[model samples]
Target: MAIEIYGIKNCDTMKKARAWLDAAGIEYRLHDYKVEGADPDRLKQWAGVVGWEKLLNRAGTTFRKLPEDDRAVADADGAIALMVAHPSLIKRPVVEYDGGVLVGFSGDKWDEMLR
Candidate 1:
């Protein structure tokens, strides 16, 4: 199975997820958005599968720090633009695995999907 995890290297959640994968002995690749940046096409694709609402990290500091107008995005395009411009605006550790994509880190969910 092809599993790619995307997140910033220094993010706390990213660290937890990486540690979990390490303990589980799951082989995967880390797409550190902070260093590598995000692909607009890929962001759009994730938005399609999970809906832009789920992909957007409204809880994160990056999104919270955005201008009020930017935060009031009423459509996927608006959210996508923000996320593409600032990858941190997207949720942490988006895992693309087993023909599907998942955003955020949850041990149960990761095990369910990967195992």
Candidate 2:
């Protein structure tokens, strides 16, 4: 299966995810948003699969630091706009496998889905 992992390179959770992938011997291409910048089209595709609620990292420092008005994202378009403006608002380690997409890091869930 072709897998692509997206996130900031230095993010702790991202590091764990990368380690887990390596331990599992899963070969994947990294799309580090810190350098590559998150693609709006890909973000929308992921949102379509997982929903914007799951894709948006509201608990992250970047989202929390946003002004009250900016944080009031109410729909997919709004959330997408916010995420495009601030890639850090995206949940870390979004994985796109051939069949589907996975958001966030859950070792058990990834093992179940990818293996």
Candidate 3:
């Protein structure tokens, strides 16, 4: 079951998710967007599965600090562009497993799907 976790390495949510995966004995790879940068193609793919709305992290400080026009995105394309430009705008710890993609961290949901 190829599982890849994506997020900023220093994010608290990323730390918690990594700890959970480690404790669960789950083998996975970390795709730290802060270091490697986000891919437009991959962002588009994730958006397709979960909807750009769910992938975009409007509540995060990065989004909050964006220009008003950037935050006023009206569609997936707009959101994707924003995310690609600012990877921090995407929700943290997006896990992509063999079955599907999971956006954000929720212990119950992670256990149900990842465990």
Candidate 4:
């Protein structure tokens, strides 16, 4: 299966996801959005699948630091713009495998999806 993992390298969740993939002998590409920068088009695509609310990390420091107006309301377009400008506002470790997209990892979920 073709798998691509997108997230910042320093995030604890991303670290654990990477370790899980490695130990499972899964070959995947890691797209570090912090380094490569998030593409607005790609963010929109993900939003379509999971919805912007699920894709945006409201609990993160980046989101908390945004101006009240910026965080007041976010649709797909608005969320994509914000994520493009500040990738840290995105939820951690979005994994795209074959025809599936997984956001946020759980041990059981990873085992079921990758095993």
Candidate 5:
């Protein structure tokens, strides 16, 4: 399957990642969280692979704005629940490529994997 990238369509980081994919002539399909809602089961699977720490976008405004009770998630289940309810809490451009997955984008890393 072609690599599938998940992120908000207008996210700056997502824009950068999309640019790299386009410039590299790579085939990919964007799964915009805004347009297509996230699945809790899929989110859980991603968390299982990369860990909830990597999947959660703690640096984003959405996460920062969360109430203490929501932010005080104690486990993967809590994190995943929040991520599902607030898709913006998800780190941008989670790429499902080949048989593996990449949680964020980097030019060098993309080059390495695509190569």
Candidate 6:
């Protein structure tokens, strides 16, 4: 399967996900949002798959630092806009594998999908 992993390079979760892929010998492409920027269209697509609540990283500093007005707007469109402006506001280690997409990394989930 062809996998495309997206996240900031230095994130601990991203590091773990990359390491897991490497150990499993999974060939995947890395798309660093810090460098490439997160695409709104892609974010919308991911939201369709995982829902806006799952795609947005409200616990992250990027989201927490947003102004009250911006933070209050938490719908799909609002969240997508925030993510487009601050890619770090999105969850870490979003991986696209073939026709399926996985947001966030859990060792068990990775093992099941990769195995």
Off by over 4 Å in 1: none
lDDT by candidate, in order shown: 0.91, 0.92, 0.93, 0.89, 0.90, 0.91
lDDT of 4 by residue, 19-81 (tens): 999999999999999799998988888888888898899999998999999998647888888
Q: Output the lDDT of residue 25, model 2.
A: 97
The residue-by-residue lDDT of candidate 2 on 34-100, one tens digit each, is 7898788888888888999999998988988999998998999999989888989999989999888
For every model shown, the clashing-pair count is 0, 0, 0, 0, 0, 0
lDDT of residue 106 for candidate 2: 99
Candidate 5 CA-lDDT value:
0.90
TM-score, each model?
0.96, 0.97, 0.97, 0.95, 0.96, 0.96
lDDT of 3: 0.93
| Residue ranges of candidate 4 with Cα displaced over 4 Å | none
lDDT of 6 by residue, 8-105 (tens): 99999999999999999899999999899999999999999989889889898888888999999758999899889999988998999876889999
- List model 5 lDDT by residue over 16-104, tens digit each: 99999989999899999999988899999998999999999898889889998998888999998999999999998899988778988
lDDT accuracy of residue 113 in candidate 6: 78
lDDT of 4: 0.89
lDDT of 2 at 15: 97
**Which residue pairs clash within candidate 2?**
none
Query: Candidate 6, TM-score vs. the true structure?
Result: 0.96
Q: Roughly what TM-score does model 1 have, to 2 decimal places?
A: 0.96
Model 3, residue 93: C-alpha shift (Å): 0.8
- The digit string of per-residue lDDT tens for model 1 on 28-111 reads 899998789999899999999999999998997888898999999989888889988999988998999988998899999988
